[model samples]
Target: MAGRAIVVTSGKGGVGKTTTTANVGTGLALAGRKVVLVDADIGLRNLDVVMGLENRIVYDLVEVIEGHCELRKALIRHKQLDNLYLLPTAQTREKDAVTPEQMRDLVAELREEFDYVLIDSPAGIEHGFRNAIAGATEALIVTTPEVTAVRDADRVIGMLEAYDVKDPGLIINRIRPDMVRRGDMLDIDDVIDILRIDLVGIVPDDQDIIVATNRGEPIVLDQRTRAGQAYQNIARRIEGEEVPFRELAESSFVNRLRRLVGIGNKRRKAN
Candidate 1:
């Protein structure tokens, strides 16, 4: 059977879309699935660096699409995971360099060899975004708990619907429990109310993500970080496993409040 082609996209920038792609792809590979990470952000590619295979990129997506090199020649195998590979994009080419039809065809080809093909989309609603989702059979929309990010995600959801890519799942990233408890940020329920999509994964605000990125390591490989576990859960869910979502960190203030209210033993489930 052909594999799945999922585009990891966020309409707004700086919402951990690329990071989510890297970690989830890595997580899927760790699950023993043959996976490929396609950097669809042509002119501003970063998936290779995030996968720690930037030095091994001899060819790129454009080169493969344009017939400059074979598909296997452009794929950079991950150092740690033999089943994980990355198809980097050409930094010198524009989004227009690869047409939507070309992307669709490329994804179809990848599906024949890999169990999963995760495309990292550029941040926008323009040509780059169009090219990114061209071949996607499914989509994961990444958004932070901020108002602007949620609003942009809503817009992207509508656009995806128009393009016949229905039921795109949502991945809420960088949620701070302290802020939510203080009413200084949007809660999970608030974001879900606004977007009204299926929730795939919820990643907590973890500092280790930055440290891992700087070292060219995907956070999913760490095993100790909450964000890494969240990504792994996403991968498991993708594999048709029923993994329960984990509770995010609760603020000390909430604990104190629960003690003061004499309900400290009460438990609440993750939304």
Candidate 2:
């Protein structure tokens, strides 16, 4: 049977779209599914770098689309996971090097073999982004808690809808519990109020993500980080699992206790 082709995208840059893609792809692969991470970023290609497969990229998506190399030659397998592979993009070519129809065709071919195909789209709603979502059956829009990123993500969500990609779930990246507790950043409710989309995952802000990126390793391998657990949750959600959203965090226990006793409110006995 053909598998799902999901695109991970964002309207603005630096919202951890690539990071989400890498970790989620690895998470699904760890579930024993055959997976492919396709980098549609073209000239700004970095998915290979993120996947730690840059040196293995003798061929890329462009080569496969243009017939310069066979599809198998373009797929660079992950070092740790035998089931995970990456179809990198060309660093020298422009986004126009591949069109929407071409991308759709390429993903169609990939679905025949892999159980999951995850495309890491370039930031923004331009040609690169269009090509990235061309073949996607589902989408994960990543954003930070900042206002600008949220606004841009809202726009991207609408664009995805216009493209007939319905119900693209939201993955709020880089969420700081401290900031949210202090009202310094948009909380989950605030973002969901504006976006009004199904929540997929909330990746906590973690410095380990940077270290893992520098090492070209997906954070999912390091089970200690909340971000890693977030990606794992996303992978399970993708597989039709009913994992509760807030239950992923330890704070859920505290929040539930607070709710149970109404401790969050001031006492009214003195009134």
Candidate 3:
């Protein structure tokens, strides 16, 4: 069966789109699914770097599209996971070098072999983003719990709707419970209220993510980090499993207690 394609995108830079793609791909591959992650950043590609496969890239997406190399040759297998692969973007080529049609065709061919195709989109609503989402069956919008990030996320959602893409899920990244408790930052609820999309995961701000990214290792491999667990949960949710969203530490204890005691359950039942 052909696999589903998901574009991991964000309207603003520094919102963790590439990180989300790497982690989600790793998490799914860890679950034993054959997965391919495509870096759609074109000239500013970093997905290969994030995956620690930059030094091994002889051909890239542009080379495949331009018939300079076979698609299989451009694909670099993961060093750790046999089933995980990466189709890196060309750092020397511009985004316009490959058209949306080429991207669609490439993804179509990849779907025949992999169980999942995850595209890491470049930041912005431009040609790179368009190409990234061209053949996607779904989209995962990554954003932080801040007004600016949420605003950009809302814009991205509107753009997706304008493009006729349905069911784009949201992942709130880099949330700090302490800041939210101090009313110094927007919480997940505020972000969801503004974005109005299905919540996939809430990843807390963690220092380990930085260290892992620096080492070309995705934090999902740690399994002990909160951000790692959150990414893993997002992967499971993408696989159509019903995983509950994690609660913020700032939420009222009374409310949390009530939730644990099934008070909210009764309210929903009554409704």
TM-score top scorer: 1
Off by over 4 Å in 2: 251-271
Which lDDT tens digits does candidate 1 get at residues 35-124? 999999999989988878888988999999999899998988888788999999999999999898999999999999999999999999
Model 3, stretches more than 4 Å misplaced? Answer: 247-271
Off by over 4 Å in 1: 249-271
- Put down candidate 2 lDDT per residue, 1-271, tens digits, no spaces: 9989999998999999899999999999887889999999999988888888888879888989999999998888888788899999999999999999999999999999999999999998999999999999999999999999999999999999999999998899988887788889899999999999999888888787999899998888765555666788889998889888852356645645764676543321111
Global lDDT scores for all candidate models: 0.89, 0.87, 0.86
Per lDDT, what order, best first? 1, 2, 3
- Global fold similarity of model 2 (TM-score): 0.91
RMSD to the true structure for each prediction, in A, is 6.6, 9.3, 7.9
lDDT of 2 at 154: 93
Per-model clash counts, in order, read 0, 0, 0
Ranking by TM-score: 1, 2, 3
In terms of lDDT, the poorest run of 10 residues in model 2 is 262-271
TM, every model: 0.91, 0.91, 0.90
Clashing pairs in 3: none
